[model samples]
Target: MRVGVDIEDGGLARITLRRADAGNAIDLAMARGLLDAARACAHGSVRAVLLTGEGRSFCVGGDLREFGALSGAALERHLMAVTDALHDALRTFAGIDAPLVAAVQGAVAGAGIGLAAAADVTLAADDASFTAAYTGVGYSPDAGVSWSLPRLIGPKRALDLLLTNRRVPAGEAAAIGLVTRVTSPDRLAAEARRTAESLRRGPTAAFGATRRLVAAGLSADLGPHLDSEARALAGLAVSDVGREGVAAFLGKRDPDFTGGAHRL
Candidate 1:
């Protein structure tokens, strides 16, 4: 049960799930730490986040040891509490003001894959393999994968992986849009950082607004979508970050964003 976070180059902050000896499996402690780290990142001055695991395996889903010995209502309560705890972490990532990039390698199964999808972008190692391991172990999907994955790759492709519990390799995962990029095992982190930094250096207000609008646009009607987009763009134009960005473009200079001028 280790929690470590650091500021990386180009405003990309990293929160590592640090149980290397246990493959960084999502236990109650790890889940709580993850949620806490994400919250801290949100309130701090960082522009982007990088989520990664410290071991060979990215994550192996819920820790069975946390659930294997429970019984009766105790088991039910334990499962429900832990599940919601994870969902809260997922929600933090889902609603973050800045973009998140996940670096995945080895096994990304069950809730681990859910965490990957919750990220704004993902970079995976070619040797990476993901699965809906829930069914294999007499469980089902948790951590909001059912909702998040479909938003990413669509229902048809998402259902195929969820229903079949099939292994989605890194290359095929990228082809199906599960992963944004695939690289050698050693390069996944660098690739994730590259993308995170790009987002960090862009118009921070525009990125935050776009993320908010697109999320609402998914279920909104056309009129509402336009209304939301218009408001978002209008808001961006007056924002401190936005104004600096526009000024920089016109002045042929780089924009220097100090972060935290507006509330998300």
Candidate 2:
């Protein structure tokens, strides 16, 4: 399989890009596999997701060699199909209650940047480098790179990267808001897993609500956003997780959201 999906204990779903030889590039099959993995994670039981790529690099980008094999309308159609699957997978991940954590290493360019940015928490290895390689190949952005980049690091910076295809090292990428944190390459996987596991033990619905609120707040008016926040908080406050959280706080204990009979 080009993508590996494993649901470990505590509802932490691990989605791995398995094309190490190709720098985990997104070919058509891998795109479809990612969609399948996303659909699996969308199941109600999943609490968190961790995305990683095997080998030295996280992902270089789309499989350009595959694209280069075709021309004319055929190439256009092929790319559309690839993006269709990839975009749908990203949308599915976004719509899920489970928060996503990405552990990126080595080269993170083009669609790889989009995938990293899409994560709720992106942990990049010290060796990781980011570039917007679309324009260099005479292609426009796909996999939501155009939408995510401007929102992530602002339009001017986004344009500079997209236009120049200049590589941004891990430190600069984090400083520019392209990644959440940077760690040593050796510790990247462990840190990501730890982060995902911590999230898995929290209130899934509340996380989902917050994710949606943040996404909406980007384009929403302040008044309407406040109203949305109010409604969301009210709804969650009455939920079982909320009750457990309150009880735990008062009892000086940690809350258990895993549907156990133990005290909060």
Candidate 3:
């Protein structure tokens, strides 16, 4: 596989897109590798995931050369399969008990943008760039960009970016709320990893439930999701960990929760 994955203390796994020479472009093999890594992270001891690039660029986009060879049914099938698999991979990312933080530097375009938007939180280096390159050529946004963009930057901003294929830098990206935080290139990794570690060491199952509720709230009305949230809270409120947390807060001491979910 062209990607690399390592899990350290705090249950945080760092997954690097390793094709820096080509600006970490997603080729066929790399797409499969990314999906595999996401699935592995979903099932592993990793509570949080830090997505990054090995060298200069986080990910330039999909390999254009790979697109040239396709035509008619073959082309349609190729594009559909890759995008579908990638979307599936990203959808699973949301289910991760701990947050998914993207540590981005350099170019992030096309499918790369999709990957970034898939993350629960994004941390970009001062030099990082973002572009929706799909319309620049003769393609459309995939990797659930249509779904994610409207949620991140609003529908109007997403339409403008997609229509114009504009290249946005870190400062502008942060201002527009596409990325959560931006730091100096030297501190990007540390900053992102720190956030991931914080999440990893916190309430695992509660985070997972919260994530689901938030996602559900995005598309559905609060009236419908209220019931779901009520059920989740009810379950948590009766749990031993919750009682301990409440006691610890009232007693002015740190909560010791041993009822951590091993499956997470």
**Which candidate ranks first by lDDT, i.e. highest?**
2
The list of candidate 3 runs beyond 4 A from truth reads 257-259, 262-264
> Would you list the C-alpha lDDT of every candidate in the order shown?
0.81, 0.92, 0.83
lDDT string, candidate 2, 1-264, tens digits: 999999987789999999999999999999999999999999888999999999999999999999999999999999999999999999999999899999999999889998999999999999999988999999988888999999999999999999999999999999999999999998998999899999999888888889999999999999999999999888888888788889999999999877731211
Lowest lDDT block of 10, candidate 1? 255-264
The CA-based lDDT of model 1 is what?
0.81
| Candidate 1: clashing pairs of residues | none
Instruction: Name the TM-score of candidate 3.
Output: 0.93
**Model 1 alpha-carbon drift over 4 Å, by segment:** 7-11
**What TM-score goes with each of the models?**
0.93, 0.97, 0.93
Ranking by lDDT: 2, 3, 1
Order of models, best TM-score first: 2, 3, 1
Query: Model 3, 1-264: lDDT tens per residue?
Result: 688888775577888899888898887778878888788788646778889988889988888888788889998888777776676778778767667889889999988888888788898999999999999998888878888888999999999999999899999999998888889999988888788877776666677778888888887887878888898888777776567778889999877653455422
Better of 1 and 2 by TM-score: 2
Best model number under TM-score: 2
- Which prediction has more favorable TM-score, 2 or 3? 2
Clashing pairs in 3: none
